[model samples]
Target chain A: MRSLTAPRRDPAPSRLSYRLQRLALTPMVRVAVRRGLPLLALLLVLAVLLGDADRRAVLTDRIADLRMQIQQRDEFMVHEIRIDGASDLVAAEIGRALALDLPVSSFDLDLEALYDGVARLDAVSRTDLRVRPGGVLEVRVVQRVPAAIWRGPTGLHLLDADGARVALLPRRADRPELPLLAGEGAERAVPEALRILDAARPIAGRIRGLTRMGERRWDVVLDNGQRILLPRADPVPALERVVALDAARDLLDRDVAAVDMRNPARPTLRLGAATALRLRNIKLTELGVD
Target chain B: MTDLYQSQRAMRAMRRAAMQRGVIAILDVGTSKIACLVLRFDGPDAFRPSEGVGPMAGQSAFRVIGAATTRSRGVRFGEVSAMQETERAIRTVVQAAQKAAQLRVDHVIACVAGGDPRSYGLAGQVELEQDHVSEQDVARVLAACDMPPIGEGREVLHAQPVNFALDHRSGLNDPRGQAGQMLACDMHLLTVDGTTLANLIHCVKRCDLELAGLASSAYVSGISSLVEDEQELGAACIDIGGGATGVSIFMKKHMIYADSVRLGGDHVTSDISKGLQVPLARAEWLKTRHGGVVATGMDDREMIELGGESGDWERDRRSASRAELIGIMRPRVEEILEEVRARLDAAGFDALRSQQIVLTGGTSQIPGLDGLAPRILGQQVRIGRPLRVSGLPEKATGAAFASAVGLCLFAANPQDEWWDFEIPMDRYPARSLRRAVKWFKDNW
Candidate 1:
């Protein structure tokens, strides 16, 4: 075992033989390499081509998406302005209120802020603006109708059906003949007064003006200059009864200055300057109710 | 001291283990009402506890099995004033709710409306042992946060890791398993009065229930009233109750600040009673029946009979017009709104992305409140009603139930509370407690 572990001497090759062996292996190396070189080259070319094609597809898709986005943005920029139910609101004034010189569909448009700006207008009751397909913008405006004219510390103003101060009506001769209301905060009384007017539409023409005294009591001045004091409990019944009495005796023709109907049970009439007439226990049935 | 710490540790372990079981109860011991809700979790599908996402999904999944409310007793300004009476009230509500659910619950998560809650935002950073950070790394960074001393007897109500910064890129929702050498965490810790929390826990324990978790009532109320957009963008919720008005601010779906005004709907009633020389009951009736902030023309003549057995004929049948009633109610409502507005202003809520003010609770139901609220609040104002909950009676779904419904949502899918973290009792930071204690001490 000791002898087997000993090192053995090997013979060295000559320089010429070593050179020849190197030369002989070079051709074998070329033969082995040349046999698979085309296959390796082809694999490299295929990988390069596949990578370039994949990158090109991704770039093309991204370009298409960008173009689509640009088109959408362009369409959104063209805002169409459509007006509806503008009885008093002029198109130019509405446009000014909107404060948008560009088309309604402009991408820079802030619809919420624009709506809020329009709502700030005193004459506009409800304003709705929406964008339609194909960049068309439809704006619907509802002008507050002047239900009555209120005279207060703020001067003359138009009241909507709810008695809310709509706007300060411009002083003009051709303005609609609206009933005038007087007293402090009389503008707030417009809403309740409109409720009464709605119930008495048949006799609305008879009312000349409605005056609210500190939001406590109301006096209706008839077209005939007859002042009718309305009851706080139920003004509708009292108004109906007054209409009946006017029809029954043609009371409008009488020399009455004012009628006190604050109490539905008893109505007192003050003659022009001399006499007073009192009527008591006037029931709804006695007023010729069918 | 050792016994207390051992018990607290046991309680924490139990809560963590019970998280997967699903059903839990939240008790809100408020000054005006003691409300209880039983929430049953359907499964994990309802909510997954991931970071920087919307609310835990469990709310829509859980069904409201039982709910009961009783007028609060022995509570003032949202703290337990009388132990026995409060204990009785708590027992009554819990027992009723437990019976209704047909299951005897042993644990309860509660919210107290008091404790002078204060918020502090803390930031900390830790170097990761490995190149890639894992969940453990996040936890280690949170633990490494130099927690400010909360003080003796005060407990941490909420300790949530709100934002994370990884290798200088902040706002990363989840940094776990990400390759980074350094991790930073921005944590929000909400601390409350120790004695208030202890009293609440003792009250629940007296009723033979375990205290699983606790939240601030103002925080939960905001959760129920605020929409997802409002919470994400930023908004404030004003909950007007009988004895106190609660204020809470929400950003990124978490409560950043909370406070309460020691005045509320009850004060308005008192004003009416004193102004009109009417009984408390009658004043409340008038306030509920015809109260409006904006008076109209018809209010002057619209009369209401003062009903009672007064000896004098004039006193018995006396009548005050609606306008007179409005005159008394409007000023009080305005005062409450102004106080809330001041609180919001002090909180710098105007700087939020969206400054929405939501008015909720019983007093918010008053007519014409929305029209008048904007004048005092000076921002977008809207009346809020609790979103409808499944299996809840229609009668229980109103602005008044905001806190109760919110508690149910909280119990079903609780966000990370202080108890959820691995806090060492012995190693608790004194400095943090001192800062939190300063708030309560100064406030009280």
Candidate 2:
């Protein structure tokens, strides 16, 4: 209901609140204040809360523990090595070459480097290394086959058909049945020397060994103290021709100390000591000029 | 007609938009200070069954995320006097609050005072469309309420259906989903000076903001300051502001009547300035620091020095006793209280079962007002502050922010108004004459 009394009225008045308002933080003032003082206060509080060394140590220990647990999981830890396709000697050499401690974590093992190292042994041609289940590390080794014996200054080394060294022996008698090669580069022409040995199998009883000539050719030696010079290129064909002549005329059995076949087109033979002496006396008497 | 519809639509749209965004700002535009508070509303999904039991029923849970208050300017007696200046001031506090909240808000629900708001109770009855009364029946009953003849230069600010009666059963709050042949409603309508609202709307618009909703500061102050029991029974909240004292009566959790006494804290300051012959600023400081109505025997010995650098020796060193300062402030405060008492009495406040009176607002800080208010207003008086809200700045959560906080409650659980529903165009057939009759019967 409307009343007779008017609301007691007054003129508007200005206030001291304005001065108080001026002291308040406007965004403009807050920007500067936050940069200088308030920001530092906030950071100081945070430092007090988070900079405790005890908490840091606990956190760091927890992180290290987690890392170790991941690394030492049982799924792939390599406790032992299983070798396949290897003889006892080859496996022993490979074990020495590997140089790994048993019961090692598989994560720490470098399988590629292990394969290369184990395969570089004299008896091993290739290797397959893997960490199988049940914490076992398996090394599959393939040992090279010895094709011939090479008499080097170091020792009597067994060689494969490709002239790679397989193993070292104490003496030549250790492998008497294998054909032997002696010289600086005899290992380099192992295939050619083996081919020559095959061609002279018809006189196998008289054959001794093959020697390298300046790394360019081969000289076949006989137990009868004869030597045959073989050409470097096409040495197999030249040796085949010698075998043909030996089959037709028993050329290898005559008293010839040396048959030089370096020039395939012209063949020559040096007489033995007795044959040369008898031939010299007859020629001197006939010519009366000795 | 279109203006009313459009304005109502605009307000409703803003409510929708604010609800969709789940955050809005409440602004209390007063003479002494302008306050802005940003509220974060947890949406419908955020409500708990435990929530529906309080005074804030069906209200979204909200927190005061940002708050900023500054000295008001270009406003007198709770009305904007200078357009540009008020716009700038509104922009200032709103921007500051937005910065604090780290968000931009377009919707604001504002509260104003000293707008000459008038309240009237209108009754209506309508035939139900079906056996089971629906929301439409309630709407029809409210529409059937006679729109009275409020004079020129006045606008309807609030139209809330205070009570509803269905057929044989009366005192029904909601008739929906109930079988009834007849529906009835008792609606309370409030109107204010049209220019007072237009000025605020234009000022808000000039600030490049939307006028989402507007409320009477007196009504909102009661909403936040009065306790649940006080509101449920009968109580009045007297908000003694800077330029005006706002008075509102509430019963059953709704405002039944509201009036304003246009003298407030500033008047007391003026009295001190005139009595002591000091600057207005110094008088305010004295009022806040040393002014009080309840003078003790030792008050005669306590002296306040008025120091100044004006270079006038006698004026610079003048001193006054605390008793003398209280002597000057008490009368203006008493006059405002007496005026509020008269208005409350005229509203039949004493006839209500509970006549508890609550004093809140900036000026309510005067010491001994609780004792002084009871004797002068002749009621059970108590000083009230707004209920606590989360994250509210320590300073802003005081009694001065009652209306600002109340605006948040009003925005959260806004009492449904007539404009929210579609009214038949012909329903307002007897608008002016009936309103004149109602006004004459109530006042004369």
Candidate 3:
């Protein structure tokens, strides 16, 4: 007799599982499930995290804190400022102008603002600022050289060749070697004044300074109170002619109050009052009318 | 008849669509197992023919990309007896094949093994209207063939134009562009039980697959197992499957006749099961491992362990001699071969020019079948295996996969069937646009 038992298990898959397997084998469905699912999950996570305003603020704050921590590292600190090509006073002035505390983070140091501040100093002509490695702020400066002195109503100020003011002088002896310019707008015409002084080097011992008359012409004053009024167009040539006359005839040694050469074609001399009375008596005696 | 032609034409169209998609499936619903093969068509220009090589038996056109087989259930005599169980089996096999191929195949070409196929020879003659025979004349000649009374509840599986002859010149393979007065042709028609065909189509449909093409198992097995010259001359293929034996005769590379016997290796296994008082599973194992048709003195000395799972240890330990196993299997194998012989004789296979008979299928693997087949089948009987196709798994290149491999070849390059040719415009009804167009052309 056959034994009563259950039948063997079938190896075939159920209809549902079979269809599911076929569905999974489809290329479009497989790619969607395999690749698209993970990407979608990542995007969903990102969206969820970024959708809340509080969470967004926290993320931004965290990023900013991280940046601040990196910026505050000791490696990025600027300890000392090395100012080059500046005199002692200008260097001190530049340091005071920048007003940056040492050992401050270089990231906090605005080089452009600092450069503009240092350049604003009357003594500094061009400034370059950079935060070098190893905690050093290097301030490279080009200082303006005093080319002439202008004695204005306020005081005497030192001016560069381009008529750019460099510094102030307390007295005229402070820069004795420099040529002096006095009167209004003299600082603007310092180049022309320096050229006239250059032409009057023949009487350099007798010349005192130059005065800009009416802000147009120049009057070259000698130490003996004699003055030569120069034409405005070419004052250097007029000054050169006066120097030649003084050299040939000792014209500057006589009692002439002023020599007027405003017109290059003609010349005039104004005598002093005492010299004029003496010259009239000498002329009457010579003509026999005592 | 028109319904059959239209259905066949629809299937051919489906096949063309599958070919354009580059992938199709081959299914063999056998009794013992249902096999599925995924074939990728690379087209004709995919590979260059070698210096001395041809198309390699038409196997070069396609490659076996995926293959799967499952133990058949709810199937008997190669027909689905239990619908639900068979559907599950098909789903399992098709899913596995798709998994292996990593592709979803929507089109399938299936073969039926136990459909009780019957073959008929039809002849017709027509007078050529023009000096030269055109394609219309060929279609007219084919349409002139009278339909045989194939009886009720039967459907035609294959209707192939076998021979075309012009007047005074017979054996003309192509009558087109030939100067002939009378054009005669012979066509081969194979029909099977209508319900069986319906069952197969419904089964494939349930699996969400379109039936692109349908072939008789006997006809396809012959296509795979028979060599080129054998097919070119004449041959017969006897496929000894599980529940049915398929017998097909081929002449001039066309299946001239096809039939099936409803007896096969399953009956032999049942005979062994009954004779040895063993279970069907154990009987099947014995049939494959040690079964043979010819028993000798050495077979008697060889003993096989016929172990049983019964609780009684004595019954479980029982053994049988190889000769006894062979004794139970020989008669059934002879009966199947005799049935095949009767089929061949009835089809007048002996009248062909060459009388080569090839034995194939799952049961043909018996060790002594080569020795026993000659006595029943002719003197030229040979046990054959399927043709070698590219990328076929080594395990599936056996006699049992003959029909599956042939289905691949059929999917790649199908022979011209009657529906493949266009019908004469006059054959259409008066309402058809083609008839009106032809009318205008003739008058103008």
Candidate 4:
């Protein structure tokens, strides 16, 4: 009795589907599903990939291999080293102290550690290490000028103005042009000794060297074995006073054994033993008792 | 009575909440179609002064963002006859509108066109205690009105104060702060069947919507279809709906009377169906396509094919002239209009300064209704369409959507009602704390 070919369909949604569509359209829910789900999935994937110890180790190894490849590029590899402002002997010493293998990558080279190593060389005062553009580690070294040669009980050594030991010498004759210093702590007083030598320049030709007495004062010795005992304080001015007396009265040319200017207020000269007995006989003849 | 008062106040508070939230839905549950409109309140301050748009009758306060309409099911005489079927229809329209808006609407303002609305006029007078009238005096005057027996199983839907008079001077819109000895007020109260109202509330609740406000469709259609001057000068709006014809009288911009007739366009369609021996669907199609209130000489020559799905060749291949269809529809349309005219006459519409009558709603689209309406409703009848609101779809701007558009304007700026005013102090319990406070203020 009814026409069933084209049935009327209900367009109204079911309660469940209606509620679900509303839930999906909710702003908070929509944003969570849109943005938060992908980020959470990414984190889950990363966690799965990196969970095993073997995989982690392989990943780190790959990273290290990649780093090595970048470091070993042609532009980064160090092929040569140049040391400036140093003698060949000091240069070789610095090279040995550095101990870097040749043709190593500049990335593998720790310039700060190499700088510390090269700076510790006894002959170097200051050293700068830098990898230049041409794959070279250029070390610009300022060699320590031996301001004074210290003669110790062990051997002879070169001393700089700041009283730092530069290098050991074979003998005193090897560096005869340098002023010599001798005492227990004579290297520590190199600058003061040099200053005393500067003030004693008036008797420059006759000066042999300066010795540190009690490691506090300087004893200036001449070529004739005559000594000037300088004071502990203001030794340079005291030495200058001794040089002024020697220049004015030819004090050192006479038979003076030593000049003691230790108190700075009084300058006492001790005559030689023979010259002292002759001076006493002259005094006795003058007093009429021969 | 106080229970319903409190509930109405609660609904007003919900409306405020919806406004604060900036989005509310308008549901017009008519006999033939259920329309849902999503309104987004941008507030009055959203408009700039230079835009040249002032808040014109509160229309500028909100915009219609989404609109949808669906053929109503299981409804008769504008009232839901089948609960599940009506609920499904509501869900369909609300879902479509929400989809268009891309928003979730929780609060709704709905209009009811069925429910057998009845109007009452009440007047009360009170001697002014002080020389100048105060808000409390106005409240006391409204409270002093004599209560009429509105009959059992009926609930008051709208109780609006329509007019106020100070001393001998009448027609005072607001007597507050005015020097007067006697304050007299006129109130308009509209009531609908309690069971029908409750059924509507339950139906909306079943669709997961909170009813923020409920209004009679007759009142709201009058609000949208009648122009400002027409309302000011007193006019009657006849809304010819599918199963009911709503009649409302507006005077001084307030609805003074409202009633609904039980006859409407569906009766005309049934008449056509019985006269031509066609299905209701085909009859409805013929009524809309070739129907007219005033048939002409040319209509007899134009044949309208009444297509059918019946297997019989004679039943399937049938034809009728446009004049025959018009003849079948005109008597029923005249009957609905005569009923509306009788209701208007009973409401003393003839005594008003203006006898303007506006015919609107789905059935008002019948061809040549304007020519036929004036014969029954008077010589001043004219068909009206709903006022244009911003962002409303072109298809929804018809006379059928008059109540829907009026619901939008109502949500933006609702009229003051009896419950909106504070209860008179004497009505409070004797030992109430506020009463004690009032006593302390008066004697101190």
Candidate 5:
């Protein structure tokens, strides 16, 4: 111990007891040790999702920008649209109906929506769309052929035999070649009306058009506004009867106002107003009931 | 006899080993508590003794790495009364310190305040072979001291040359490389009860630790608590511990006289416990918090709860005035201080020119001990705490750790003693039994 206190002899005692020092290491390690990168990515995504409004908007804009970049690639731009099987005027009308801007990215356009839009035109029957090489967008359109003109409370419409819209007409005289069909269900009865018109071919000039009555049978209106009421069941055979009468007795050419063929067993005719008045005065009331 | 010599040699070797390792443990075994401290020494480059700077620098070479204290078990007056219980208590402290340090230590230097240590001062002289005194001449002179009869079951604990004289000149700190015809040395030898030392050694071994060194608590307490100037001149350190009061006198930076008193703070606690009809633990708390040697008119107004924790509401709520507590605690504290004064007086401490006394240890925490100690001990009494060591936990830097801190200093630079030097075996006394060589004594 004297060596210890020999005052200036050994200064080593200045470096003293340190055996018990410990590091606060466990807490730090608990914070650092985790399954590394994926957890960080998950945290980043959650941060973005829960962030302020501006952050969400920024993400949405970035997604849209990325989509545009993909869609605007040189090979994906649409340069032109072509319509097949249509008259020039109808084709121009189809183009106007489509209302698509050329050079728009093909990916930017919804082809199904374009097809539906162009098919809204009365002349178009079918539409096919494909993007060919060199950024050309080809549109194939089938135009509807008018089978008849339909005159209803809404006006006159030229219709195909299958009841599809061919075009809208200003006046029935404009589509004189088309068999005139009228009434509420006239459009749907276009095919039957055309068959009935064939049975009335002998009285074709006197025939004005066909009117659908109560959506069940057709009323054949001849010149001078006479009517032929065809039976609901096999109206074509009833129309053939009208044709047979017209051929055997020139029935459609008489001053008859209307012919009732609603019942196949019995057919009747109504005279003109003056004639009906004279006949009533002559005591023909048993033959005509008002 | 050879086995005993082997043991002494082993102790010397252990000290060297501790120095080499640059880290060691200091254990204070007292009747009230056992404290262990792990100390780290500075490398050779950082040790500069000139500055007199203690190891309190934040990054100083020596620092406390770990410290643990446990209530002593099966111990009385700093002596182990029950071996197994003492071993268990030692294990508790050692393991706690090891855990805190996160390292295991195999060597320990322990301090005991008991064992009835007795000190002897003797002189020896030898003619130098050459005109100059060498380390050989110093060793021969140390070997020339006449050993005293220390009675049976006692062994020399410290054999150190306190001072050296060469021919007509004296007061030589080192006689080596000096021209001299004759060399003389003053050596101090301390002896403790052999059985107690043996039990301490056995207990440490049972704890799986090697007893590298042992010191009288009184000696280390003086070393750590006495100011350097007081040590250089003359002073006495009185360590009033839980079970024993350790007293040592230092002159010229070496302990020349030492003694112990068996009654200590525990006796005062017991007095309070009995006087108030309270449990020992509660009485201890009262004594520490409210104990005073001098009471004033205001003391009666200060009250302390003498409550028992025994689940009896009436007893638990009992209160005692501070004056009454002082009445119970004063006499006991006075008695311990008086015993220390007697020991100091017996050692002829009053003859010293610089007669300062320092009081230290766990029980020295009494509020007015410095004021009370001087009334009993001396006019220049002061409360002493261990010098701050670097990185020492604030909790471990109290008067309680005086011996432990002193041990750290000693481990860093222990003075060379007779055993540290090589003496020729042929110079051994012919009849070495009943007594060791002339330089040492073994009373087995």
Candidate 6:
């Protein structure tokens, strides 16, 4: 049912008017689209690249700062050192011993290793090394006290409590007040016997050198060279009985070359080569009987 | 063909036959080096295990026939990496030692460092056939311990029965002739990677030596380094080698656990090289000459010259301060200690009654290490040297050579190995699954 006839239209506008409209709108739209997109994309790329470069710069700067800080810290720490309880060690000698030729300010000293090296000296028993907050080095040393002086073929060496050879005492006008040990195996035997003697210190002063014969028996020599032959069995009782006899009869003062305590019950005394005194069943209580 | 039981019997005979021989060589395949020691056990009186830590009765008795060491090759973290290189190194050290001893040997006992070794504490019970227990019964009770599924590619390195618990009584060191209806055993099974074992055995065979026995390097090191009391109670040995550091825990004179850390002295040297911008060889030399963990004030001004080869006047004349050297060395040492602390924590070192920690090995020689180690590793730290052995060179007695000297003592008096006695594998109890699960839960 569509209408077959079309309606009439007004006359077309002039070419001048059409050209004016096109001229007014085309360049504006083109400029808006073209300028906006490229500018946005360029801005985004530039931002991303700048961000990456900034991050790299920040990381590099941080690492450089850390390196500087470490170097500064090391330099700052190198100046603080304190030495404690080093009276016995000469400063020059210690420096020489540690092989330190650099100036004090330039030397990064390892106090503990230095302490260990110092402790390696026979005279040093214990040592402690510590660093204070300011990088000051502090060292403390405890010198070993010689328990006895062992006279060997090599030289006169100082012995510690455990019978370890400590050092050779310098021969001078003033020597350490320690007991002297002599004989072939006296150095080995004295330490062991001294441990036992230390347990019995009340009478320890009366004895001097202890000589072991055949590795089983021991001969205790008095300070005045009186030999006391100790029995193999029950030596403690024999020692105690001798102490009692000496206390009661002053037998140590007798002109005797040797006293045999082999039999705890029967004590024998050799005053001289020909004169021998034999006392049988000399019990601790028998001191009053004599 | 021998059945399983007959094969076990024949294995026992073979063990006895190996023991009767006079000389046995022990090779300690450590990450740092391969050491071979040939020992001659002069009958029963020559060596006796101590009752407790005191002066050992005899000192001048044991004879060291010969010893030698070579740089370990093809070993990474204690496990054999390249079999051929390891074999060659072993052959070189063993041949040199044999020549020194002027004797040819066949039997060899060796110790390895790595294999992801795991330990389990197992208890087993058996009713006595008689009223009183016998040595046979003791052996039977030990054999009754169910062998847990050791996993594929793994073999038992050490399966030692540590303690025995008789019926209504416990801590019975020896249960023979004791009256008990039930005997329970506390056994420790140490398992290592089977591939590692095969490689070690192959290397020994290629060197033309018979396998007398094998021990864990950490176990033997603990045996030689720890005092008797420490071993009887409990202790740990940390052996810091050039390539790796080994850790072992001992209780009741037996190794309860062992482990290794891949970092060691080599890491420290590398850190120095990178920090100082020096060559590795120069860094090592500097580390040995001037390295210290704790820096002192005097170190800042101490200048060390860097030898230059390019003839650049400015670079050749340049010097770095001592404090700078310490700065490079401290952090790496601290990291090593921290790693060791973490390992000890994992091993439950704090739970031990006598928690003695002994430090040995080449890296332990660092300056101020003893001081810094105790602070990081907790209390009870000591620097350990090998127990003074007869005829050992003075240079070889330091902490660096603990494993070498320990191998000597181990070869002389070998503890019972896993294959020494018969193990009834067929009668394994089913409850071992639950035990293994429990161990996994506790350890992992």
Worst 10 residues of 2 chain B by lDDT: B50-59
DockQ of each: 0.00, 0.02, 0.52, 0.32, 0.01, 0.00
Q: Candidate 5, fnat value?
A: 0.00
- In terms of TM-score, the best-performing candidate is 4
- The lDDT for every candidate, in the order shown, is 0.75, 0.83, 0.90, 0.89, 0.79, 0.71
- Judged by DockQ cut-offs, the docking class of candidate 4 is acceptable
List each model's interface RMSD.
47.6, 7.4, 1.1, 1.2, 9.7, 52.2
Candidate 5, superposed: residue stretches over 4 Å from native: A1-290, B1-5, B42-61, B428-444
Candidate 2 wrongly placed segments (more than 4 Å): A1-290, B43-60, B422-444
Model 5: per-residue Cα lDDT at residue A278: 86
Per-residue alpha-carbon lDDT of candidate 4 for residues A1-290, written as tens digits (9 for 90 to 100): 69968878887767676667667767888899999999999999999999999999999999999999998999999999998889999988988988988999987898888989988877889988899998999999998888888888778888889888899999888888898888777888777888888887778888888988987888999988999999999998888888888789999999999999998787899999999999999999999996
Cα RMSD for candidates in order: 45.1, 19.4, 9.4, 7.1, 29.6, 42.1
Model 2 per-residue lDDT tens digits across residues A1-290: 34456875522212233222433434555566768688789889978866999987887899999977887887757778889999988888888888998777787899889988987787888788888889887888777889899999887999998899999978888788899899889998898888888888887777789999898999989888888888877887887788788889988888888888888998788889999999899999899977
Residue B49, candidate 5: Cα error in Å is: 14
Q: Higher-TM-score candidate among 2 and 4?
A: 4
Retained native contacts per candidate, as fractions? 0.00, 0.00, 0.86, 0.27, 0.00, 0.00
Output the lDDT of residue B150, model 3.
96
Q: List the residue pairs that clash in candidate 2.
A: B148-B435, B149-B435
lDDT of 4 by residue, B150-180 (tens): 9999999999999999989999888889998
Question: Positional deviation of A125 in candidate 2, in angstroms?
Answer: 16
DockQ of the two-chain complex in candidate 6: 0.00
The DockQ assigned to candidate 4 is 0.32
Off by over 4 Å in 1: A1-290, B1-23, B44-57, B149-153, B309-314, B422-444
